[model samples]
Target: MLINDGLVRARGVRYATASRFAKPEPLAWDGARPSERGPACPQPPSALAALVGNSVEGLSFDERCQVLSVTAPADASGLPVMVWFHGGAYVTGSGESTKYEASLLASEGVVVVSVSYRLGVFGYLRDNLGLLDQLTALRWVRDNITAFGGDPANVTAFGQSAGGDSVYALMLVDTENLFHRAILQSAPLGTRSPERAEMTAALRSSISVDESTSVEDALAAQTAAVTEVGPKFPPSGGMPFAPVLDDVDLTAAASRVELLVGHTADDGSPYVPSREHWEAVTELIFAGGARELARDWAAACGQVATYTFRWAPADAPLGSCHCMELPFLFDPDGWRGAGMLAGQEPDPVLAGTMRSLWAGFARNGMDALPSRSLEFGG
Candidate 1:
């Protein structure tokens, strides 16, 4: 019932085929087919949605999202692998988010795997199940990426926002060669990661809804409870959903790998008290935290590179706010969903620079890399 042409054939100088290599669901089954995009982890509407013209509302979200997509150049073998994680404050986003497209990056001679993991109450309400989900996905890539013409040995991970925090988690966890390098963009590392009991207490104390709360009602109430507080959320009482430092698996060796970390200039504006507060937060949360991680890695293993993105469109009211660099790094043409953060059109020169830097890191392992890490607003 099968034909050779259907199994393996090409058009336009490239041939591609995909399969659901693993079924991570509770109900495991084999012979998974590659047909459609996986569901995104569910989440409430983002507040930034209003400011960004509700463009973020229409994309996609669902529960069955613990999957990954790999794209590679044709005629490729032993190519490095770059797995990507998108950011939505541990609540929103998926590997399918328009911002994490892997085509452009894969075109540069590496296998690009965009991963989706659990989020929100499904992830961190009790323990770090979402993080565990990410670990599982990474393990899958480590074991099977070679089938896609990728080099299992030269795996690299890159993430942004909450995704960036996940990358940092890889450094603290016992990765054991799961990946050889990482890139963290706009990671909120300074945010406090409390111990397990403390974090659980924060969640318990934040919302009062009992079992009677419908799934949708509970999700709404929980989102309101956490966001009602001022910009710097998960306030004084507890942290509803953040990584617990104490739960780190100490038995596994601490990860040592070349790292690249960065944040945009106005990263804190929409989340801080005033313009002045935003500036202070940028110093404390982004710059200071990057320096600490860099110094620690400098002492531990391979070299570290850090950058600050100061480029903002002339008319941008919020300046180079959180995740402003994503469009430049991913797809400038398809980044309209980014709204005001990326402006009408992004800077091509800056895009080329970032593309080169990231691809080089994915290839060369930080032994030799560019240094103009900071890009002042043009």
Candidate 2:
């Protein structure tokens, strides 16, 4: 997307543009429609990718990988937008992954924009640059989404895992009307981020590339392999990269935004080794954290609702583990490659239910139907 909205930021105006991303020149456009998937940022090997043989997890890395995709109905205008940030523990994955082909969601009425941002050291270590990238994208959506037939006033920022953390960050950072709704899906909200120095030292020790390998290449490789299922991830067995909480940002007046936050019934099932405290793990790490955030927001701003996704595919050993509900929620047809979600229970009827709920929130600022612990039994 060509940046046609830079100058507006220099003025005292907090917003960047009426639309952040402009239609690219012919050669610059990657495909017929912006919704066609684009390149992913650099990341290392992922155990998740290895499991499903999903190339997206290990797609070739590119530094200039800030492209985004938008899916919208051909006849629609002034539609609500759902801006998605893909999850990969702050180090892996991309919005370009086919697992996020939001066409069906857009087909239901609203527009969907899946975005890409810098990961690992390029984004977090030297500085909090990844989040800066995200902020820039959100600002772009605010200014340019209208061109894509989206309503700037009715936007919902949502994501799962690391992306969910980013949605939380946006809630904390965006006081200037960027998005009116926020959805946090299976985010490790309570896991404290490790120090950059510690993470760097860990990477420096774990990496064993060829002697001639550049420092950046080694770091990137290590970062990719060091994900949740990887041996070196969580740096020292906990989350590594995170937004440094500025007392100013954390303590900002509560966002004037509604919240729809939730987690899988067993978010920690895959990440945590033992099933003994899996329930506790979910509560301590994701669900409980969201509750605290919701209570805090409800007191400070608008309405808040929380639900647990309890659906399970028959092949799933652990019920509703991390990201197991995503395929049904975003793209049931393209969800196959993610390994975490199998085709066991993804019927069109189920997908339609999820679509109805998500679309309702995006359009109306509240859930059309209250979702308790929703169960998609196999």
The lDDT leader among the candidates is: 2
lDDT by residue (tens digit), candidate 1, 236-351: 22224655655443223224577888888888776766889888877666667777777766666546788888888777777888777877777655467465654467787887
Worst 10 residues of 2 by lDDT: 7-16
The runs of at least 3 residues in candidate 1 whose Cα sits more than 4 Å from the true structure, single-residue gaps closed, are 1-35, 50-60, 193-199, 205-214, 227-240, 247-255, 372-378
Among the numbered candidates, top TM-score falls to 1
Off by over 4 Å in 2: 1-36, 50-60, 193-237, 248-255, 371-378
Question: 92 in model 2: Cα distance from truth in Å?
Answer: 0.7
The clash number for model 2 is 9
- For model 2, which pairs clash? 17-143, 18-143, 18-144, 19-143, 19-144, 20-140, 20-144, 44-224, 123-130
Whole-model lDDT, model 1:
0.65
lDDT of 2 by residue, 316-372 (tens): 666678877687777665566555655464667877887878888889866564653
What lDDT does the true structure give each of the candidates?
A: 0.65, 0.66
